[model samples]
Target chain A: MKPIQVALIGLGTVGCGVYQTLHIHKQRLEIQLGAPVELTTVVIENPDKHMKIAEKTTISTDISDILYNPEIDVVFEAINGKEPAFTYLKQCIQAGKHVVTANKEMFAAHGRELKELAQKNEVQIGYDATTAGGIPIIQTISQLFRANQIQQVQAILNGTSNYILTQMRDHQLPFSTALKQAQKWGYAEADPTNDIEGYDAFYKLMILSDLIFDRQPDQKNIRHSGITGITDEAIEKAQQDGKRIKHIASIKYDETGNLTAEIEPIAVPKEHPLYAVEGVDNAIHLKADIVGDITLTGPGAGAFPTASAMVEDLCLILSKQSAPIPVS
Target chain B: MKPIQVALIGLGTVGCGVYQTLHIHKQRLEIQLGAPVELTTVVIENPDKHMKIAEKTTISTDISDILYNPEIDVVFEAINGKEPAFTYLKQCIQAGKHVVTANKEMFAAHGRELKELAQKNEVQIGYDATTAGGIPIIQTISQLFRANQIQQVQAILNGTSNYILTQMRDHQLPFSTALKQAQKWGYAEADPTNDIEGYDAFYKLMILSDLIFDRQPDQKNIRHSGITGITDEAIEKAQQDGKRIKHIASIKYDETGNLTAEIEPIAVPKEHPLYAVEGVDNAIHLKADIVGDITLTGPGAGAFPTASAMVEDLCLILSKQSAPIPVS
Candidate 1:
C-alpha cells in the first residue's frame, strides 16, 4: 500500500504531539494499519522551532500549502480556537481531504454543520481527540452502545476544574489559591476562564449529546454554571453532609420530550462513580437501558494522550477500505 | 438498505438476552444503522421454551438449520463449553457466515485459529462479549490503544471470586458459605470450579493479552492460582495491613523480555483502582507507554450486558459499509 501522507495545521503542543507520537509508534502503527502514516507537511508560525523534527517534511506558513498539497490525504487540525482552525478545516474538507481535529470549541459550535459539510464534500471528519482525551468515549458512544437507549450521561469533563475542585476540597484551600496551584502544575491555562467558567465541559457535553442522543441543545438555552462559584464554605458543608462536590456535566433524556442538559457543580454521594474520579482525570458514566451504568476514566488532557487519539483516527481513516459509518 | 439477518444458536441466559435486547432496541437500532436487524432463526435445546419470544422466527434443535440457511448472514454462538458449541461455530465459519460469540473458553484456546479461518472464509468474527463483559474493554484495547506500547495489564476478571472474597471479608463467612451465597444469588455456577479455580480469569487474561501486549503466554507456563486458598484469617490480617485481598489476573511486560502472566490472590492497597471495585463488577487497568494508567470499570457478567456486547458486534458488522479493522 502507498504511504498515507498527512499534514499538520499547527506546530503547538498537540501538533508537535501528533508528529512525535507518529514517530514514536510508527512501526507498530504500520503493522496494525498495514500502511505507513507519513507526516509530509506541517503548517506552523515558527518553522525554525520545529526544524529538528520537521526534517524531510515541508514547512509552510500558509494553510493553502496543506489544502492544495496533492499528496496530503489527511490533515490534523490542531490549531486552537475557532478562527483559522475552523476556516482551515472547512477548506480542507471542501478540498476533499479527510480531517482529524482536537478543537472542541469549534466542534461544539459547528459540529452538525461541519458534519453536513463533510458529507456534502464526500469526505470524513473525526474529532475523537476533541472530547476527553485518550478515553475513547466517542467511539464507545457511537459503536458499543448502539443497541441501548442512553438514558443519562454524567461526566467529570474539564480536568482543570476537577484539579482545582479536588485541591479546594482536599486541602481546604480557597478557589483562587487552587487555581494558581493548578496553573503552576501546568494543568490550567494562564487565562483558564473557559475551563473554570464551565464552557469547556459544556462544549464536550454538546458533542456527546450529538453522538448518543442525536440532538444538540442550544448553548444559550442550556442551564450552565461553573466551579468558580463553589465557595470553601459550600465545599465544607457538602463534606459535612457526607457528600463530595464535583463539577458535573449531565444530560438526561426524558420520555416526555424534555431533554435536559446542564453543566454545573453538584454534590454527589460517595457511592457515585464520579466521586472516585479526582485530579486531572475524567470519567464518563452512561446509564444505558441494557448495560446499566458503565464508567470509563483516564487522563482527559495531555500532549501525548490527545495525540494518541489523533493517530488512532488517522489509522482508522487510512485502514478503512471504504467510507465509515456516517456520524451525522 | 436490506434488513440484516441474524440467528442465535442457544436459548440459554445470554441467548435469550440477545433475543430480548434485539426486541427492545429494535427500532432504535434500525434508525441507528439505517436498516433493520431481523432475527431470522433461533437454534435451541428446547424450541418450545422460547415460543413467546420466538414468534415469526424459525426455531429448531438442529444447528445445521442456521448454518445451511443462506438468508442468515450472522450467527450468535452463545452455547457454553467446547464440545458442540465449538464444533457448531467451526461449521458456521466454514459455511462463510459471520460469528459473534460469548464463549471465552473456546476463544482462549482457539481464538487465533478461528480468526484465521474467518479471514480465510471472508467473514468477520467478533468476541467482545468473551472477555470482561459489559466493560467494552476489548474494543478499547484493540482500537483506542493502537498508538501506544501497552506495558502492563492488571484486572479483576473473575467476578464470582471477587464476590466470594467480598462475602468472606465483609460478612466474615467461610469459603464454603460464601460460595453458597454466591451460588444463591446466581453469581456462581453449581460446580463453580472454573471461576473459583481461576481458570475463568486465566482465560480472560489470555484474551486481553492477545489484544493489549500482543503476547499470548501459554496457559501451562503461566502461574495460576485461585481464591480458594484465601481464608477469612488472611483477609483480616490483610485488612490490618490496610490492604484488600483481591483475586488479580495480571500480565507484565519487562524490558528483558520477561513477560510475566499470573492469576492468583493478591493484596491491593487502598489507592489502587481495583480496591474500589467490588461485587460482581470487573475493572481493568492498562499501563501504557503513552497514556500511563487507564482504568475501566463495569459489570463483568450479566445476561443483558453480554447480550449488549453481542448486539454491538452485530451492528458493527452490518452497519459498516466496508469491513472493519481486523483484530488479530
Candidate 2:
C-alpha cells in the first residue's frame, strides 16, 4: 500500500497536538494502517514561528497548497471557529479530498451543508473530535446505536462550565471565583463567555440533536440556559437535598417523535450517572429503545485526546468505511 | 443493494432477544443500512418447544441448514459452551460467511485462531456482544482507540459477580445470601460458579488483552481471584475506609511493555471512576497514552442489551466494513 498524504490547517493548540502525535506515532501508525500517514503540509498564520517542527514538511500560509495538492488524501481542520477554515474545508471537499475536523463551531453552523457537499463529492467527512473531544460520542451514536431509536441524549458537554460548577460546589467558591480558577487552570478561555453563556454546549447539543433527530436542530427554539445564573445558595440547597448541580445538555424525543433540546444547569441526584462526573471531563448518556441508558465519560479536551479522535477518523477513512447513516 | 440474509444458532435468552429486536426494529435497521436485514433461519436445540416467536422464520435443529446455505450472508452465534458453536463458527467462516456471536467462552478459548481464519478467508467476525454487553467496548477499543497504545484496562466484566459484591457491601448480606438474590433477579445463572470463581471475567479479560496487546493472553498464569472470598467484615472495613469492594478485571503494560493481567476483588477508593459503577451495570476504564483514561458504563448483560451489540455487528458486516486490523 502507498503512503496516505495528510495536511493540517492550523498551528494552534490542537494543530500542534496533531502534528506532534503524527510525528511521534508515525511508526506505530504505519504498522497499524499498513501504510504511512504522512504529514505533507501545515497551513498556519505565521510559518516562521512554527518552522521548528516543520522540518521535512511544508509550512504555508496559503490554503491552496493543500486544496490543489491531489496527493493529500485527507485534510485535518483543527483551526477554531468558522470563516476561512470553513471556506478552505469546502474547497478541500470540492477537490475530492476526505476531511477530518475538530471545529465544533463550523459543524454547528453549517454541518448539513458540508455533509451534503461531501456526499455529493463521494468523499468522507469526519468530525468525531467536534463533540465531547475524546469520548467518541458521534461514532457511538452513528455506528454502535444505529439499530435502536435514540429517544434521549443527556450530556455534560462543556468541560469548562462543568469544571467551574464542580469547583463552586466542592470548595464553596462563588461563581466568579470558580471562573477565575478555571481560567488559571487553562480549562477556560481568557474570554469565557461562550462556555459561561451556554453557547459552547449549545453547539454540541445541536450537533447531537441533528444526528439523533436526523434534522438540523431549530437553534432559535432551543431552551438554553447557563451556569451564570447558578449561585452559592442554589448549590448549597441542592447539596442539602443530596444532589449536585451540573451543567447538562439534553435532547428528548416525545411519543409523537417531537424533539426538544435544552442546555441548562440542573440538580442531579447521586443516582444519576452524570452526577459524579467532575473537572474537565465530558460524559454522554443515551437512552435508546434497545440499550436503555449507556454513558461514556472521558477527557473532553487536550491535544492528544482530540488527536486520538482525529486519527481514528483517518483510519476509518483509509479503510474505506463510511460514516454511520443517520435516520429521521 | 439487495437484502442481507442472516441466521441464528441458538434461541436461548440472547437468541430470543436478538429475534424479538430484529423483528421489531426491522424497518429502522433497513433504513439505516440502506438494505433490509432479513432473518432467514434459526437453528436451535429445542425448536419444537420454541415456536412462539418463530412465526416468520424457518426453524431447524440441523446446524448444516445455515452453513451449507449459499444465500446466508451472516451467521449469528448465540449458543453457549464451545463445542458445536466453535465448530459451526469455523465452518461458517470457511464458507466465506460473516459470523457475529455473543459467545465469549468460544472466543476466549479460540479467538486468535478464529480471527486468523476469518482474515485468511477474507470474511468478517464480530463479537462485540461477548464483552461488556451493550457498552460497545470491543468496538471502541478496536476502532476509536486504535491510535493510542493502551497502557491499562480496568473493568467490571462479570455483572453477576459485581451485583453480588454490591449487595454484600450495601446491605451487609453474606456471600451465599447475595448469590441467591442475584440468581433470583436473573442476574446470575443457577450454577453461578463460573461468575463467582472468576472464570467469566477471565474470559472477558483475555479478549480485551488480545485487542489491546495484539497478543493472546496467558489465561493459566493470570492472577485470578473472585468475590466468593469477599467477607462481610472486609466489605464493612472498606466502606469505613471510604472505599468499595469491587470484582475488578484489569490488564496493565509496564514501562518494559510487560503484560500483567488479574481479576480480583479490590477495594477501590471513592475517587476512582469504577467505584461509582454499581449493581448489574458494567464499566471499563482504559488508560492509554494519548487519551489518558476513558470509561464507559452501561448494562453489562440482558437479552435486549446483548442483542443491541449483535445487531450493531450485523450492520457493520452488511456494510462490508472489515474489522479493525490488529496491531502486531
Q: Which 10 residues in a row give candidate 1 chain A its minimum summed lDDT?
A: A319-328
Per-residue C-alpha lDDT of model 1 across residues A126-231, encoded as one tens digit per residue? 8988999878788677656777788899999999999999899999999999999999999999999999999999999999998877788656557899999999
Candidate 2, residues B39-94, lDDT tens digits: the string is 99899998777847656678899988888888888899999998889999999999
Worst 10 residues of 2 chain A by lDDT: A319-328
Residue pairs clashing, model 1: none
- Each model's RMSD to truth, in Å? 3.2, 3.4
Candidate 1 ranges with C-alpha deviation above 4 Å: A46-51, A218-221, A322-328, B46-53, B169-172, B321-328
Give per-model TM-scores: 0.94, 0.95
Local error of candidate 1 at residue A174 (angstroms): 2.7
Docking class of 2: acceptable
> lDDT of model 2 at residue B80?
92
lDDT of 2 at A224: 93
lDDT per residue as tens, model 2, A1-328: 7787999999888888888889899998898788988899999887777737656788899998998888888999998888887899999999988899999998988888898998888788889999999888898777677788888889999999999988998999999999999999899999999999999998888888777887854666578998999998999999999999999999886676567788999999989999989999999998889977899999998888898888878877776543222110
